[model samples]
Target: MEKKHTIAITVEDQPGVFTRIAGLFARRSFNIDTITVGKSEKQGISKMIITVIGDDRDLERVEKQINKLIDTIKVTEMPKKSAFIAELCIIKVAVQDKKIRDDIFSYAKIYDAKIIGMTDKTLTMYLVGESENIESYIRLMVPFGINEISRTGVTAISKDW
Candidate 1:
């Protein structure tokens, strides 16, 4: 069965690190759902949280290839129960009428979204939640006419010490 996997990787903070990691996924033809990278708690190091949908065998191969990278210091597949995951999305919708704006506001409220930017013809919303929750919001907002969308990808942390 194909399942969502979040892989956490720690690597040295240097140039071309992202390209090297992304190349691994591209070479394997794995569809990357999302990838988030940022500085880690340790100095001179960086962390990456990659979300991909694939079967167990594909995931194993990805892990093995990632391990071969010289910059990679550690790699771990986060367990479902032990990880707290979240993703951020920014969506701009076209709303020319009051009724459409009101309807969008109602839906955003239900999804705990915030109206971050607004203009006469467009409204931009910021949402932070699980990947599934964000997808649901995107589907619901499609009827309102989405003009643009930007996602911050996935970030996860282990719950246990």
Candidate 2:
């Protein structure tokens, strides 16, 4: 059976690191569901969070392959129950009228979405939470007309428990 897996990698902070990692996935014919890269806690290193769907056995093999890469310092598959995963999303929606705008604002309040920008006809909001919550918010906003959406792919950190 196939299942979703979140893999966290610690790699050297150097050019082409992402390209090499992406190429590895491509060569293996594995689809990356989501990926996020940023500076890690240690200097001269970076952290990459990648989500993929594949069989457990195949994923284990992929992890070993990734670990063999030159720039990779460590690779670990984070279990959902043992990690806190979240994504950041920014959505712009059209404000048709006062009632529509008010409704949007109300929904935003309920979802804890912060209004970051506004214009006579548009509202831009920033939301950070689980992907499911963000999807639900987008669903609710569809009727009001979404202008655009940009999301920082899922990022995760291991829980202390």
Which structure among the candidates has the greatest TM-score?
2
Instruction: Look at candidate 1 and tell me the lDDT of residue 64.
Output: 88
C-alpha lDDT of candidate 2 relative to the true structure: 0.94
| Model 1: worst 10 consecutive residues (lDDT sum) | 78-87
What is the number of residue pairs that collide in model 1?
A: 0
- The deviation in Å at residue 130 for candidate 1 is 0.6
lDDT for each candidate structure:
0.93, 0.94
Mind giving the per-residue lDDT tens digits that candidate 2 earns over 1-161?
89889999999999999999999999999879999999999999999999998999879888998999999999988898899999999999999799999999999999999999999999999999988899999999999999999999899999996
Residue-wise C-alpha lDDT for candidate 1, range 1-161, written one tens digit per residue: 89999999999999999999999899989878889899999998999999889999989988889989999998999867888899899999999899999999999999999999999999999999888899999999998899999999999888876
List residue ranges in candidate 2 displaced over 4 A: none
